[model samples]
Target: MAGGGRLLRKAFPEHWSFLLGEIALYSLVLLILTGVWLTFFFAPEMSEVVYQGRYVPLRGIRMSRAFDSTLHISFDVRGGLLVRQMHHWAALVFVAAIGVHMLRIFFTGAFRRPRELNWVIGVTLLVIAMSEGFAGYSLPDDLLSGTGLRIAQGIMLSLPVVGTYVSMFVFGAQFPGEDIVPRLYAMHILLLPGLLIALVTVHLMLVFQLKHTQWRGPGRSNRNVVGKPLFPQFMASSTGLSFMVFGVTALLGGLAQINPVWVYGPYRPDEVSTGSQPDWYVGFLEGALRLVPPWETNVAGHTLMWNVLLPAVVLPGLLFTVLYVYPFAEQRLTGEWGGEQHLCDRPRDRPVRTGLGVAGTVFYAVLLLAGGNDIMAYSFRISLNALTWIFRIALVVAPVVAFLITRWLCRALAEAEQKRLTRGQESGEVRQTVEGGYASDHRPVTRFRPGAPRRPIGPGEHTGTASQEPSAPTRRRR
Candidate 1:
C-alpha cells in the first residue's frame, strides 16, 4: 500500500505539446462512445436488399443490406447522422493527434532509452488505427468505400506468388464477394478497436513507469519531473479537455457533412467515381499508387505488379519498419545506447535528426499530394500524365532538398541560441562610459522554461533601471 497513494499523486509535465497525446486519448474515447451507439442501428451484412429508405434518389434501388442500414442510420434513426459524423470526425482527429504526438516524441528524442518499447507500441497503434479507419469506412459498402476496398484488393493481388491466395483469403472468394462487408464490420468493430485499446493501455502504463522527457532548462533534470499532481490539477484539465473534444467533434458531426454514403450510391462492381480519394491518412498510399510508373515482371508465367506492390506494400512496410527501428537506430548512431535520455533535445540542438525528420515529412507530403494528381489535373486543367511525372520527379528530389534545408536551418538556429545565451538579451537601456562610448546593457536569460510564468522578476533577470546607472560616469575616477 506504500505506492498506492503515489498513483493518485502521479505528476504529468505541463506543455501544450503534451496535450497531443491527451487529444488522441480523448478522441479514442469519443470513437468508442459513438461507435457503440452506431452498432445498435448498423447492420453489417452484405446480403442483397432493396433500399426502401426515405432518401428519394436510392429509394427503390437495389443495394446491400449493409448499405441499407447505413442509409437507415442516416435518415430513420434520430441523431444517427450526427453521431455518425462525430464518429467519423473523431476517428480523423484520433489519427491526426497520434501523428503529431508521435512527431513530437520523435523530434524531441522522447523515444530513446527506456521509452523505446513505448515508441514501438505507439507505431503499432498507428498502424492499427489506420487499419481500423479503413475497415470503418468500408463497412458502409458504399461506392467510395467499395473503390477503396477494390484498390486494397488490387494491392493484395499485385503480390507475385501468394497474391491470389491472399485476395481470396480476405474477400472469402474473389473481390466484391458476399462475405466482405460482414468481415470488415467484425474487424472494424471488434478486432482492430480491441488491439488499439490494449496497445494504448500498455503505452500509458509505460509512460507512467518511466520519467517523462522534458525540455532541458533550469530546475529540470533526469530524476525529477516538474508539473502538477494527477489528483486534481491534471484530472480536472483532462476532464474539461474530454468535453471540449467531444463537443467539437459533435459540432462537426452535426454541422459538417462527411462520408455521405447515400450521395455516393451503393457499391457496384462495374462503377467508379470520378475525383474520388480516400481519407487524408490513406492519401499517401493512393498517391504512391498513382505516381509509380507501370512496370510488371513475369517469372514462370506468374505476373508481378511491381507498380502496385512497390508503393502500396513495400513502401508502407519500409516506413513502419523505420518507425519501429528509429529509436534504437538513433541510440546506436549517436553512440548513446543504454543511456537514458530524460531531457528532451530541442530540434535545433540535434541537426541530423531534425533534418531526417523533416525529410521524411516532405516525402510523405509529396506522396499525399500525388494521391490527388487526378483531381488536381482536372481542377487546374493540367495534363494528368504531366502532373504524375512531375510528382514522380518531386518525390525523389523534394526530400533531399528538405533534408539539406532543415539541417542548415537547425544549425543556424543552434548558432543563434548560442549567441543568445552568450550575449544575453538586450535590456533596452543605453549606458555611456567616461570615454563617451555608449553601449546597450544585455540581460542574461537565466531561465528557459517555455509556457511557464514569466512575471515576478525571477533570478538573473535584469531589474536595473536608469536611476541605478552610474551617475555622470563617476566624475572622481582617476
Candidate 2:
C-alpha cells in the first residue's frame, strides 16, 4: 500500500490542452455508470409485445419487447430517463473529446516516435467507441436506430462477393430478424466496452512509460520534465474535471432532450420517419454517401456499384489507412526520423504538417455540413438537388483552398516571429538624436532574458541551458 501510494507521485503536466484527454476519460466513466444503471432495466429481447406503457402514442401499438421495455424505463421507471439521456450525452462528449484531443496531438507532434503506437491505439478506441454507441442505441430497437441499421445493412450488402452472407450472419437471419438486439447487446455492453477498457489501460501504460511531450519553455528540457505531482495536484485537477463532466451531462440529461425514441415510434421496415439522421460521429459517412455521384461500372462479368462501394466502403478504408500511416509518412517526408521527441512543436513552426492537419479538418467539416444538407435545405427553403451539388463542389474545393491558406498563414507567422526576435518590440516612443535624426525606441526580446543576444537553435536541438548575456564589445576612442 505504501508503494502504491508512492506511485501517485508521478508527474503530470499542468497544461490546458492536456485536459482534453482527461475530459474523454471522465466521460467514459460517466458512460459506464449511466450505462450500468440503464442495463438494470433495458431488455434486449426482440419478442413481440403489445405496448401498454404510459406513452400514449405508443400505447396500443405492437412493438418489440426491447422497445416496449425502453418506453417502460423512460415513462414508468424513476430517474431512468435521466440515466438514459446522460448515457447518450456522455457518449457524444466522449467521442468529441477524443477528436479534439487527437487534433491536439497531431498539431503538436505528440504522435512522433515512441508515441506512435499510442496514437494508433487511440484511433482504434475512437472506432470502437463509435461502434459501441451504435450498438447501444440499436438495442432499444427504436425507429431511428432501425433506420440506421437498415442503412448499415445496405452498406454491408454492397461489399463484393460475401455481402449478403455477412449481412445475414450479422442479423441472424435477415433484415429485422429477432436475434440482432441480443447480439448488439452483447457487443455494446460486453465486447466493445471490454476492448475499450483494455486499450485504455495499455494507452495509459504507454503514456506513463513515455511521459508527456511538453511545450518548449524555460527550465524545461527533453531529458527532464517539470510539473505537479499526480498524487495531489493532478488528482485534484482530474477529480474536479470529472465532477464537472458529470454535472454538465446530468444537466443536459434533465434539461435537454436527445434520442427521443418515443417520438419516433417503434421500428417498422415498411415505415421510416422523414428527416431522419445518424449521430454526429457517423455524420461524415452519411454525408459522403449523400455527396457521392451515383456511378457504377461493369467489367467483364462483374458489376461494381461505385455509388455504394466508394463512399461507404472505399472512402473510410482509405481514410483509416492514411491515418494509420501518417506518422511514418510525415517522418519520411520531413526526414526527421531518428529521435525521441519530448517537446511539442508550435503549429506555426511546422508549416506543412500544420497545413495538412487544417486541410483534413476543412475536408471533414465540409462533409459534416453536407450531412445536414437536407435539414439545411428544408430550413431555408432551398432546392435539395442544388444544395447537394453545391456541397459536392465545396468538398472538392474547400480543402485545397484551406491547405494553401493555412500553409501561407503558418509561413507568415513564422516570419513574423523571426522579425520579432531580430528587431524586438517597438516601444512606440519617438526619440531625437543630437544630429536631429528621429528613431523609435525598442526593447530587446531574447527568448530567455532581456539583455542576451538572440541565437537561433538548430532544429530538434535542446541544450538544457539558459541564454548567456552578450559580452560588451571593445570601443575605440579618438
Candidate that would win on lDDT:
1
In angstroms, how far off is 137's CA in candidate 2? Answer: 2.3
What TM-score fits each model? 0.91, 0.92
lDDT of each: 0.86, 0.85
Q: Taking the tens digit of each residue's C-alpha lDDT, what string does model 2 give over 139-204?
A: 888888998899899898888777888999999997989999999999998999999999999999
Model 2 RMSD, rounded to 1 decimal: 6.6
Clashing pairs in 1: 287-371
What is the lDDT, from 0 to 100, of the residue 209 in candidate 1? 79
Give the TM-score (vs. native) of candidate 1. Answer: 0.91
Clashes of each: 1, 0
